[model samples]
Target: MPDTLYDALIARVRSSTKARVVVEAAALTGGLIDRGLIRSVVDLDRGEVDAIFDELTRGRVLQAVGKNRWRFHHELLREVAAELSPPSVQRRLHIRIADALVAGAADGTPEWPQVAHHYEKAQRFDEAASAYQKASINARQRGALIESQNHLARALENVERLPASHARDLHEVDIRLERGFLSSTATGHASAEAAAEFERCLQLISDEPGLALYATFSGLWSYYATRGDLRRATQLVEALRLRLADMPDWYRAATDAVFGSLAVFRGEFDSARAILEAAALAVESLDSAEIEGAWFAPNDPVAGMYTFVGFTRFIQGDLAGAEESFTKMERRCQTLPFPHGPFTLCYGHTIESLIRTEAGQTDRAAQLLGDVAAIGQQAGFDEWVMIAASAGANTSSRSPVAGGARDPAALEEHIQNLTVVVEAWRAAELISFLCWYDAALAQTLLAAGRKEEARDRVDLALQMAQETDWHIYDAELLRIRAQTHDCADAVEADLRAALELARRQGALVFELRAAADAFRWGGEPHRAELLAVLDRFPAGQDWPDLARLRSLVG
Candidate 1:
């Protein structure tokens, strides 16, 4: 029925070739037409176009929206009219429309996707590719990651239509690199698709050493790092370091940041702290000229370095140092460019929450998690959202547990929710902090008096730590393990090992925790050790561990 109506309208407009031409052109552009655009594309005078527009509007085939604008009353009418033109004519019309749109657009104004749309329809692959890339950048800066990804995919498709050449390959490489970065942000960095894109980019790279290095570090190395494969990440960093003599200062500083993070993963807290601090300072002072052409960079180098610095300092029992580093991180994020602001903020907030939670400030910690979630949601990054959700659940769950509450049902409910979140994280391959969550879940289980379950959870976490070379959380797991056992000998042995491991890692926070647990539950055998650890902290810190230690021995 709709087709019959469209056919009748087409027959009526067919009386004049000019009217038919006008109808076909408008249909080709999806029935959207303005007098200026129609007059530009078609060789019709203003009065003649106005008469055609009046006839179409009177026939109910076109709707007059405003001055010089008209759209098909029904989309099907446009589709039917479009079928009247041959492919050759359709291609000519598309080229004319694209040229007109380009001619009218201002410089630096975002490329209208309509221009790309017409170019693609006209089989003009080169122009289409360029237009799509610009649109992708515009979408990305606006935080529309999915839209950006779509534009990039179209750009890549258009580039593939061009004949093979070194320049084409280079352009393809650029598109893939951009797409891979977007994928890592839209999906998780640990996603297999993101890894594959980077790998493909590396294979295509011939004369672009900087791009190759960028792909290696940002895409490949980051995939492993986010997946908790610290061993592979360390290997990549070491390989990059081997060529340090040929690299720029920014590359060198980025290498330091990556190494610092890997060091923290391996429980080398002191080394990690020094590396990250130096890297943060170097990155802050470097000029734009010194770092030009360096593609191997974090979203925000200064904030990225300080994020690791804060975490390392916190683990090493330097609360003041952690606080100072986090302050710097927050300050830098305020003025970061698009795509950097939310991500750096999320990283900074996550670490700050960890520090806040450790200092017995549950409310503050929860608030930070909320902020991280908001940032992630606003930025359209699901990884941080899931991270915030999982971490938030653990935080709220543990807050009550720390108050000496022993409601098994409530604790079980929390465990179930966390278990669901863990499954989601696993599905998304967001396992960077999987061990941390396991340790937190074990803590909750212990609070509910489920010693057997807690022990099982802690064992799984320890096994994961060993498998991934992620020992940063081992000391805390061992301390938790001490509580799961009923035998006095087993308890003392675990506590002693926890304390030793904490000290070996230079994790004063964990060391004090282990020592405090020893004094409280190990029959005061570790009283002197606890006192020694306590003496290392400043006099007036509000750390929960320090508060617990004072309450116990005073």
Candidate 2:
């Protein structure tokens, strides 16, 4: 036999009875020499254990680190000693050690890595998978996202070793759902990998509609929403509604929350408000027992419901209501165990920054946008960074009438930044965001007094909006078109079209803007029309657009 320290240790353990017992016990307990444990294992007194340690230390096999603590001089020696036992004996030892560790763990939650190792050594694949899964959950709770992902992969590897069955399929789907959620949280965008995982889950859960509904809400919705495929998202919503009466309480609540968000994206503020309110109430009423067995109930749909409602209220010129809803969303996210699930805090902050910018809190808006921009950049989320940059551009480009002087250099910088954002969106094929960014760019150009360039930008934005059927920004684009026109009749025609579209879409903020523009260009008759519309909204006196309109009228 080849001579090595490990070989020598093994040979010594095999030759001496005391050395064999001490080495076997040490190997069983993961190579740590517990003196009292050794005495108990070998049935030796304390003095005998000290004699055994002295002999092992003199032979360069064990080293004394502290009182009652000793370890093999080389870990490889311990491994070799562990292998000296027969295969059957080794497995039984692994089981015994694993049981002891489980019994000693606090709250029945063992140190997962050690538990996983022992279970694997004992050839218990299913138990190892469960241990790894627990490890992943523990890592996630500690905010070690990447480590959690690795643990999940290990769990899946063990899961694949199990025989095929309904339970096995369900376990696989659950793992995939968690993987998808984690992927989205880490990158701040829905990944194709996550979409594939969700698709796999759907295939596996075809017969279980309740689980399928959860998969659709958690996976399909995220995929279509992030891609800006509003038509597909709408179709999915319709399909879910067809089965609404059959869905469980949690599923119904989540579906309505998603539907409300889609409605907000489509500029159907009235429908969004009603649907979101129902969703919020439904989710709030869910009991812990009802959701105990859910595989992917990490996100509180109620928080998302409030967020969409807040966004809708902001667009409808209900600033106070929007602030209240956003505050609720913020508080809910803060209280959640894993708050950065579906809708992240950065997303909430972005909307809040936009509201502040519109409410004349430019400094506060800038600070909020800066915070999100840093977070986005750190996460490598281009879309989030782009949102922050776009909002920053808008905040920086405030005109003299808005209490800030226009800087030509700042306007040009905004155009450049927005150009980059537009190109990035185009590359991603995010048509909705691309069109909105185009409109934002045109607004910057208009503020810079570059009428011809502004007209070109707005025209492109309108064309893209039409091509994609993304009418959410149609009113805003039409208003910009009105500003680009030199002729009074062309300006009036565009303003009237904008006002009608905004009114039909329930976009009160855009309608107010169009009405103000109509009064500025169409003279006495248009002014009369503006006052008539303003007369219906007495509570809007504090709104930025309405406040400006009142000053102009006076």
Candidate 3:
């Protein structure tokens, strides 16, 4: 438990974001503790609540019309107070108690029935629903499927009583859907139920302009990014960006941190760098009240926003920056629930692996990628599926597992993994990552003696890249096409197009690979010119860039 009333309030507010408003309600209910509005009441000493109220105003969790009267923030609490009905205190009480139970705290365990009594008194059905859902999870863990289903149905009943506009109703549904999805663990459906439920929330949010929208948007971003849909993911981000136009600097900074990975995946590296750089500067804002307030903060999912910023740093090839980000992420995860999920663990290891790989730590990189492969082999088809196959797919694919002196199984395997992601993305209709993946996979396959398969993959890669007008990928696709036809001098056009794009983007690896390929096919002047340029570059064991990749063709 937190030490002070302010700390408790902050923790509450941070968990649900809506709790920020609930904090005001909690105080109002406390106006007369004799009133049953505040239940399972714990003593926080006299003046502690008053101190919290004072900080509430100063913190601007809500605003005041006059000194005596106060309300929650207009953007959050105000609308939520009117249109969005919260679950009953009794119901929320049960959920909290269950959370305590999950945390292994026995003190709150015996209090569930009391919370249920209050819930029945207030007729707060939705909180009852959440409580039931929690009960279901607990029941299922104890191998009580019948009890779990009964609790789940009761939870659904709470959702039924409210109108579509009631955020509590919608939130309950989200909880139920997430729970159901996890329970079913759908193997064949690609977790479409989860994705579809998320989509529903996304649609509903367009009609609401309060805290629900923020919550919905955050969840949607995470869903789309994890599911590999960058275009929609981009829209979610831009929506957040537009919403933050006049928002406080703190919230804006937080949003940037959460969305950093989406931008990185979208290949907007410089833009990602800018967003993360700004977020990296926000760590100074942490304090005890604020830390406790993580529960109240809106749109602060992916705790240790800085941890994600560190990931962006990793993506951008900054080892020191990545280390800093990972450190914050590790700390923040300690405070949040199940901090290391498949997503976080996979990301952590991959980033560490890349850093080690780039720093000439082959043994370390091998250990990291090797571990990733082992864990990922069983996780089934989803994001990890894509990641497991794509590691070192580009540069090291041609080398054997440990980089054979002159063999190409490693490269072939990389291409195979790339093909897997390509097929998945094409099926998922995610064109951007799909295009890049296809182009790289084609090159890998071609180098590995799988010429026929390479041709088809290359054609698709070029088509998608051309369609998107992603010039970086487009050039690589073209050079590939030219090479396939043995177009000789015609290859220069493709290499030049790719070279110009790579130069502008600082895609050093891509540039080298394309030029190297051009030299191999076009020969003479092209070969001599590309080598001269390559010599000017510093030698720190560059990954198999385009220049190196092209050499594999010979």
Candidate 4:
């Protein structure tokens, strides 16, 4: 009684009441205190509760925060009291409270963090691990990616407590995979942390080759692709193909989708399209259950395949086809249940806006880009926000939207904003996106008649693209160069080079645009070949590239 508040609180909880009563009250109160809530102890026997409350209040250990609610005057008082309880007694109380809170809940879902805390305190590590994993999922759904990652780390810590067993290993692998996926999504590219997790998963699941393949395809390839390690990504693709000889249809389909995505990054458009088309068909054939387990859930692999398909078609001047593919992806994503976190959704909207802009749907494109900016900002998706801003700026400079025509001053402001974002990406070592935005900025500068600055920007972009093997925009960069160069002969040479690169990459849209430029620069022999390329596209006449081609050819 004469001791300080902490000592007195601990001694009182330990000696005043039966262990059951003390531990129960401590457990319930500890949880409430952690949540910054104060509660009245009405559930305990009225006489006992009154006596305990009065005793604590008299000692100045508990204080009334509200009319009928009381809390420990200081958090240390509650912590000390909880620590002083017998370990077994504390564990049992934790379990009892966890059960009560988990059951009879208002919502059917458990409060994962609270449940995880109780399970961990009770030393029920397996349950703790599961609860933490669920908490991570919930956090991810709410766009709390760093919180999700922290939960996964705690889950893995609990996983380490279990005795060695196949089930334990599987749990560890699952947690690592989820962590890897979350890290990749949060960063807009694979991080070394994600790669390490995926590598650990591969090692853990070595006996299960199918699961190993899943790990490799789900994360490793993306890491290599994002890092510009095309050779390693190609090796992974080949390994997956070899393994596919014996894998199930769903697995093969998912693997093919991943391979298709890799090929898209490699600028192998024809091969990418073929593989993705097969993947799309395979996904369509899947039954409900197979589809559920086929890809990493919540971020569907089939939806990703459609994203690549749409992007590939967009680059090929098949605007209508690209629109169809993007619409399909959006529809598939809509079917996912709550907490539909950003995955390809932001990218889809960003690119779709670009397509809309090029097709002269300026107002609609502006609205979609606005959505992209908003979603990216809310979700902490910096890469998508940068991409959306770059695309939006370019679109605004070229054509009027709901806003009036962008004057020279507005265009310069957009360029300056884009420069800041691009530099930030560069500083962050987001190499692929940096290169992409450099090209975009170059195009914007060219459009604004800043030929010297545009030339310098495009050259830098081309250098980065070649250094990184990110040739997806190679032809476009060359075309931008053609626009910025002063000499007619230099422009002709640049356009011809662009045409060749576009043809090699099967970027038909770039090819048409370059050929149109060549014809415009008085390279008369390009006329017949340009018409033939334009004729191959069944639609997209309204697209800027095709429209320019048609005008020149006519």
Question: Top TM-score: which candidate number?
Answer: 2
- Residue 217's lDDT within candidate 3 is 60
Flag the better candidate by lDDT, 3 or 4: 4
Clashes of each: 0, 0, 13, 0
lDDT of each: 0.79, 0.71, 0.51, 0.71
Q: Candidate 3 lDDT, tens digit per residue, 393-433?
A: 53354334224332465464575666676676667655534
* Position 239, candidate 2: lDDT: 76
Query: For model 4, what is the C-alpha lDDT against the true structure?
Result: 0.71
lDDT of 1 by residue, 182-222 (tens): 77777666767777777777677743555455545555776
Model 1 — which ten-residue stretch has the worst lDDT? Answer: 289-298
RMSD of 3: 15.8
For model 1, the stretches where C-alpha displacement exceeds 4 angstroms are 1-30, 34-100, 206-208, 242-248, 287-301, 407-410, 422-429, 521-525, 538-540
Each prediction's Cα RMSD? 4.4, 4.0, 15.8, 5.6
Candidate that beats the other on TM-score, 1 or 4, i.e. the better one: 1
